[model samples]
Structure formats: C-alpha cells, structure tokens
Target: MRLTHTGPAPARRDDWQTLKNLWPYIWAYRGRVLLAFACLVIAKIANVLTPVYLKDLVDGLGVPVAVLAVPVAALVGYGLARLTTGIFGELRDALFARVTQGAIQQVASQLFQHLLALSLRFHMGRRTGGLSRDIERGTKGIGFLLNFTVFNVLPTLLEIAMVTGILLWRYDWVFAGLTLGTIVAYVLFTLLVTERRMVYRRTMNTLDSQANGKAVDALLNYETVKYFGNESYESQRYDHDMRSWVDSAVRNQVSLNLLNMGQGLIITVGMTALLWQSARGVTQGVMTVGDVVLVSAYLTQLYAPLNFLGFVYREIKHALADMERMFDLMANHQEIADRPDALALQAKTASLSFEAVDFSYQADRQILHRVSFTVPAGGSLAVVGASGAGKSTLSRLLFRFYDPTGGAVRVNGRDIRDYTQDSLRAHIGIVPQDTVLFNDTIGYNIAYGRPAATQEEIQAAARAAHIHDFVTSLPQGYDTPVGERGLKLSGGEKQRVAIARALLKSPPIMVFDEATSALDTRTERAIQEQLDRIAQGRTTLIIAHRLSTIVQADHILVLDAGRVVEQGTHADLLALGNRYARMWQLQQSGEDK
Candidate 1:
C-alpha cells in the first residue's frame, strides 16, 4: 500500500523546547557528570601545560646550547603530561557514555510506558510502524546531546578559554584578542549554517521513516501480497519510497559538504592570522623561535577540539529536535487516570448495565446513541446486529476501553469508571472476535492471564477448550512456540488457544465476541461446549454473527444503527419476526442448503 505522509516538518524552535523537557533525566546523572567534568578539567590543564613547558625549554635552554639535556628532559616531561591527559580524556569519554546510556534508557522507558498507558483510542488513530520509528528516533537525541555536548563541545570551548589566557600572559593582547574574535565568529557561523541545513536533514529523516514504515507494511502483509501475485507492484511501491529517501539524503549531504568546506576556509584563515602575529612578535625581539613553536603547538592542540565543536553543535541541534519529539510524547496528557482514591470493584451482583450511554470514535459521528441495556445476574445476554450497528462499541464500553461520552457503564450497580482500571478489568475476561496470540509457547499463551497458574490448571483449560490432546501430540507439547501472531498454527488451533487463555482468567463477567467464528464446525462445538459450562454463575455478553451460537442465550438484543431494535429470548424474538427473526431465518436458510 502507498502510505501517505502527514504533518509538518519538525521546527527548530520546537526541537529546542523539547530538549528543555529532558532536564529531569539529565539532572539525574549529575554525580557521574561531575566526575567526568573533573577528569575533563585535568585533561585540559595537562594540554595547556605542554605549551608552557615548550616555551620554557626554548627560552631557557636554547640560549645555553650546551645544556641540551635540559631541553630533552623538559620534552620528556611534556610528552608524559600529554600521555596523562590522553588517559584522562578517554576516561572522561567512557564515563560520559555511561551517563548518556543511562539517561537514554530512562527516558525511553518512560516514553514506552506512557504510550502503552494511553487509551486504546489513541492507538487506533496511529500507525504502529510510525510510532515505533518515532520512539527509536527519540532516544538518539539523549545520547547525541550528552556525548557531543559534554565531551566534545564543552571541552573545546574550555580549551579556547585556556589558550586565550596563555596567549595574553605570554605575549601581546593582539593575538589573544584575535583568537577570541575568530572563535566567536566561527561558532556563530557554524550555528547559523547548521540550523539552515537541518531543514534538509529533517526532511531526510522523515522520508527515512516513511521508507521504513512502507517496508514494515509490505512485510506484515506478505501473505496477502503473495496470494495476489503482486510482487512487482510491491517492489515498485518500495522503490518509489526509497527514491524519495535517496533524493532527500543527497540534498542533505550536498549542504553538509558545503558547510564543512566553508568552516575549513574560516579555520585556515584564522590560523594564518594568529601565526603571522606570533612571527611579528618574534621579529621584534619580544618573542623567540620557541614562542612561535609554542603558539603553533597550542593552536594545533586547541584547533582539533575546535573543529570537532562544529560537528558537535550540528549534532546537538539534531539531538534537541529528537528530544522535543520524545518529550512531546512523554508530556502527552492521556485521558486522566483513575483517581488515587479509586477502589477495587466490589461486585455483589453478576450483572452488566448501561445507563443511557453515548459514545463516538470521533465527535462528528456518533457510533452509539443513548443506548441502555441490562444483563440480569448470572444471565447470558447476546448482542445480535449487522456490522456498524454498535455491537462491538457496546462491548468496548462494557470493558471500559473507552468511557462513554455521556452516561455510564456499570457492573453490580457501580460505575465501572469509579473502579481502578486494573481492578475492574481483573474480573472481566474477553475472547475478542479478532484473537491474537504472542510468539511464545502454547502453555505460556494459555497461562498468559494467570502467569502463576500450575501445569494442571493450564492443562485443564486446554482440555476444556478441546485442544489438550492436540497440544500434547505436538513434538514439544505445551512448550511449542506459536510463531508470529500464531501463524504456525491453523485458525482453529489459534482460536482454541485464545479460548483456553480466557478460561484461565476465570472472570465472573465473560465477553465472547464471535469466539467460535474462526473455528471449524467440530472445533466450534467443542469451544461452545466449554463456553456454555463457563457461562454458568457468570454474566456473559456475547456478540454473535452466527445464529446457532446465541440460540440458547437468556436474552437476545437486536441492534440496528446503534439502537436496540428488538430484545427477547431466541424463541420470543423469532415470534416477533423482526430483525433478530430475519437474521435467524437467513442463517437457517443458508444451513438448509
């Protein structure tokens, strides 16, 4: 499928604002950061001291040429200092990495948790591949900013200050002033150019996500693609996305190259001016050959970090952009969570009731009217309706997946919303029409709701679902992995596993939405038999397309366009000869054939 791109490109101001939200996670690693800074300071001092040692060797030992050993000894000391600095520099980088990793993981974990906690409505509106890409991209900002800002940019800026101080002390103010002015110009220019170029980079990033998302979609629907023999169509679609990604990438690269070349020219000119001034000082007898050497050495030492600072600044900007997206996700105000004082559901009666409930997926269109229904204690209620008649919407409200826009859904005469979501859902079991299975062992899938359930309990549930013998007959028995979305198993086998899972929950309120729809006649009979046994002493809400499945229900609700058009027992509804009766007759006619 050709995916449509939505939304505007990430704005720079938005990105900067996003980074500000990450202060909490960054501040948490301050202790380790301080130690890294201490090491960095030591490294910078060692580097600056090398220039001083060189000056001493030249001015003191050069005039007394016979004292060559003094210069040699000073050279050894300088080399040793450089070695020590390098060691601490490495240590600082390593420690900074540790801090960045921790921060990234911590923020990532929070984002993951928050997204998962968001209402199901939010999930339905978003693409899974796009969300996953955003989450992955968001973590990168933490690592990029922490590593580049602390280890590279900060140290480079510090070195500039140190070099400036030494230049002022050793010679005239001309060189120091020149150095400071040039550094400021370089920084401002780099920031300006990078900010402009990031427009292209951001475009590239967006296209990359699209490409990834397209690949994900194509792979996910591979079975359908193969069945339709549309390999060429799929390939062309992927190629189209990749072409866009490549075009964006090329534009980004060209801009980056131009920026780098311009930066290089600026650095070359600044170095030339600084050295020329040093040479003039030497010619005036206020400086010596060694003074020029000292200037050159210090320039080399400082310029390496200075050059890297440009790259680091660009990275920081990009990182902040990523940070902003992540922070936005974290700051998302999900539907307010249950109040702190929310209590567990105290279910005195096994009844489900909707009191004039209203709901809609979007405000413009109402999916459910002011619907009302009640399932008597220990009674089975069947919701029978055409597609889009709000049968599924009713089930979702009963489960509190989305709260009603008005009115309330209650269990045992208490509003479900008043109970903590966890506590309320704990007593509710569901076998969704679209059953999904994790890629895990059969036994694990069966016991998913009750992780602590014993082998006996798992086996018993499987037995009731009439799949125990088949499961044991497999090579790995209960330990066999179900493969992705249970693709390795047949439709009937997967449905049986879902039934076994819900049965293990053993909830007082069971929702069976076309539970046996995916199964063959034999498997349906077996599963229906188990469900019938479980429905005893429990309030059951069954949404059924198959007439046979709800024939024995205590009450049948026939919905038409989000309203209850008819309600009665199966025999009574048939006598009325309305929607339910018509549906039953249709199914009976098909069965007769």
Candidate 2:
C-alpha cells in the first residue's frame, strides 16, 4: 500500500518563544536552579583568577635563583585556584541535573496527553512512527539544551566580560579592542552559517521520520506484504527515504566543519596579534620579560572556551529545532471538547433516542439524513441494512464520537451533547465489529474492560462468551499472549474476547455492531443465546447483516441507503412481504446451501 504522508508540517517557532515556553517547567524547581547558578558563578570566578595567579607566580620566579627562593606561596595559590574552578564546576552539574530531568518529564508527559486529546480527525491523518520519533528527539534534546545553553552560556559570557575588563585596565587599548573584534566576527560567522545549516537539519529530520514510518507501516502489515510478495518493493521505498536522509545529514556535518574552521581562523589571528605586540613591547624595554609570559597565559586561558562557544551555539540551535516539533504537537487544538457547563450523564434506565438525526463525516458526503429512532428502557432494537446503509453510523452517533449535525441524541432523558463525553461513554459499552486489543495477555485484555475487576469475574465473562474452553486449553491459560493487536488469535477468537470484555463492563446500554460476523452458523447460535440472556433488562442496539441473529429483537428496522424502509417485529415484517421480507428470504436461501 502507498503510505500516506506524515502529519502536518511542524509549525514555525521563534527561539526566544520556544525557550520561554520551556521555562515554566524548569522553573518549577526554582531553589535548585538558584543553587546551580551560584555554583556556576563561583566556578567562573575561580577560573578567571587562575590566569591572574599564574602571571604573578611567573613574575615572582623571574629573578636570581637565590632570591627567587622557589616562590612556593605563588605556586600554591595558582594550584588552589585551578582546583577551586574544577570543584565548583562539578557542583554546578550535580545541583542542576534534577531540574533538567524534571523538566523533561513534565514536557513529555503533557505532550503525550495532548496528542491523545486531539480528535479522531487528527489521528486519522497521523503517522505513528514519525510522531514517536518527534517525541523521542524532542525529549532527548531537553537535557542537552538545559545543560549547554543554561550552564555554559552564562559562565562563558561572564568570563569574556572579566577578561575584557582586565585587558583594558592593565594593558593598551589594542589588546581588548582586538579581542572584542575577533569575537564579534566569530559570532556573526557562526550565526549566519548555522542559519543556513538549519535547512539541512530540518530536511534530515523529515526524511528520517518518513523512513521510519514506512518501515513500521510495512512491518505492521507484514502478512499483507507477504501475500502480495512485495518485500523488494517495500525495501526499495525505504532505501529511497534513507538515501535522502543520508545526503542531508552529510551536508549538515560538512557545513558544521566549515563553521568550526572559520571560527578557528579568527581566534588564531587575534591571539597572534596580541602575542606579537607583547613580545615587541618586551624587546623594546617598554614591557618586562615576565609581562610577556603574563600576556601569553591570559590569552591561552581566554581562547579555549571561545572555540567551544561556537560549537555550543550551534548545538543550541539544533536542540531548539527538535523541541519546536514537540511543542507544535502540544499546540494542536482539541477539536472535541466538553462545554464548561456540561454535566455528568445520569443514566438510570438507559433509554436511548435519536430525534430527526442527520450527520456527515464531511459536509459534501452525507452519511445519514433525517433518520430517527428510539429504544425504550429495558428494550432491544435491531437495525438491518445493506452495505453503506449508515447502520454503523448510528452507533457512532450514539457514542457521540461525532455529534449529529442536525437534531439530537438523548441518553436516558437529556441530550447527550449536554453531558460530559466521559460520563456518557461510561454508561455505554460496545462490541465493535473490528476490535483492536492491546499487545498483552488474553486475561489482561479482558480485565481492561474494568481494570479493578477480580480474576474470577474475568473468567465468568470469558465463559459467557464461550471462549473459556479455548483459553484454558492453552498452556498458559488466560496468560497466553495476544501479540500486537491480538494478531495471534483467529478472527472469531478476537470477536469472542471483545464480547467477554464488554460483558465484563456490564454497562446499562449495550451496542453490538456485526458482533457475530466472524463466527460459523453453529458457533453463532451458541453465542447468540448468551448475548440474548445478558441483554435482558438492558437497552440494546444491534446492527446485523445476518437475519437469523435479530429474530428475537423487540423491534427491527430495515435501513436502505440512510433511511428507514421498514419497521416491525420479524413476523410482522415477513407478513408485509416488503424490504425486510426480501432481505430475510435472500439470507435464508444462501444459508440453506
């Protein structure tokens, strides 16, 4: 199958705004953040003083051997300064780790819940692999972003300021001026080159997600691929996606190398100019030999982090890019939301009604029109229809999956729209025609209906659906694994499991949409007896293709194309010799053979 494109492109975001959005989660642990910053500042202070101490130590030793006397105090001061810098740096990281990890946990949790809250329309167009990849990259980026941008940025800037002040105060204007100019040029180069490089990063991300989505889609439909013998076709498509990704990633890396080289060139020119000027001063007797050593020491200390600074800036941009996608997911509007004044549904008797209902998935393709029906409290109604007769649409409307465009659906007595969706759904249980289960044990799938249910209760529901014997015959009994989406089980077995799950729920309102379609005639009859018994004293709605299954319904309605064509009991419809009668005759003729 031709896979659909990944969901909508990530929305554009400003770096400052993205950081602002991320701030609240990190700031939740404000005390830890403050302590981390204190450590960061102390480390920078010690780091800057190291070069100062080294210059003094060198100057003190530049004398006759007897007079120099080892300069033991200067040596000890220098070593202590270096040690302080390292100790505080480690302390800073230790204090800040909790903040970084906590923020990541919060943002990831909120995004996951937001994705779930989005409407069915949004999910229908989403690619699972691509979405998961976005979430993965985004969460991992949080740590790098917090550690690099927050920790390094402040201390690096502070060091630059301190070095600039010292150069201007203790030396000629040329020294400080040259250092500032070189840094300016370096920063401008990094920003411009990085902006250009962002295109490659974004393209690589898109291609990677696409490649992943295609592979996952192919694997999920592994049986379909084998049946059509299209393994090579699938492989070729995946390779095409990967080829694009590889090219984009290569471009990104090459650009990064070029950026680094440019940065290195600028730093080299600045440091050489200052060193040459200092040496010239020493030779001319304008500055002492010890002064030359001092200048060299200071320049060495400053230039190291400047090179790393460019790299940090580049990584920050990449991290922001990753984060923007996850925030974009969080930005998606929840299409289906309950009104603030909506009340919980009070489903006492579970009477259900559709009053002159009309609906369509899209405006141009109407699925139902002006159709109306009702099932009284403790009564059962069965709907019969040809394909595309909008029978399943009825159940969806009752569940409020998509609210009817015209008229209303009432549960008990109030309009369903006036009740919270959760409360409304809690009172209704359905055994869907296509049931998809969790990748878990058989007993676990049944218990999902009511999570707090006892093991004995689960077994009782399993037996009622006539699947307990089969489950027990397995080596693991109820613990038998269902695999992904219950793929290991036969279609009838999956259907029975669904039935047991719904039975376990024991909701006041029940909906069976083509519930027995997967079973043979004999098995269908056996399961039907249990269904009929369980549906007693409860409102039930059945949508069926087989005529024999609904013979016991209190009322049966024949639907053709979106309208009701006949309404009566089985005997009443047969006597009329109309649409329902014709449908009954056709199904009976086929079954006899």
Candidate 1: where are CA atoms >4 Å away? 1-8, 63-80, 346-349, 591-593
Q: Output the number of the lDDT-best candidate.
A: 2
| TM-score for each candidate, following the candidate numbering | 0.94, 0.94
Candidate RMSDs in Å, in order, are: 2.4, 2.6
Candidate 2, which segments miss by more than 4 Å at Cα? Answer: 1-12, 63-70, 286-291, 346-348, 591-593
The alpha-carbon lDDT assigned to residue 128 of candidate 2 equals 92
The deviation in Å at residue 306 for candidate 2 is 2.1
Q: Clashing pairs in model 2?
A: none
Q: Where does candidate 2 have its weakest 10-residue lDDT segment?
A: 3-12
Scored by Cα lDDT, where does model 1 land? 0.84
> Residue by residue across 139-215, what tens digits does model 2's lDDT show?
98888899887677778888888888887888888888987888898889989999888888888788888999889
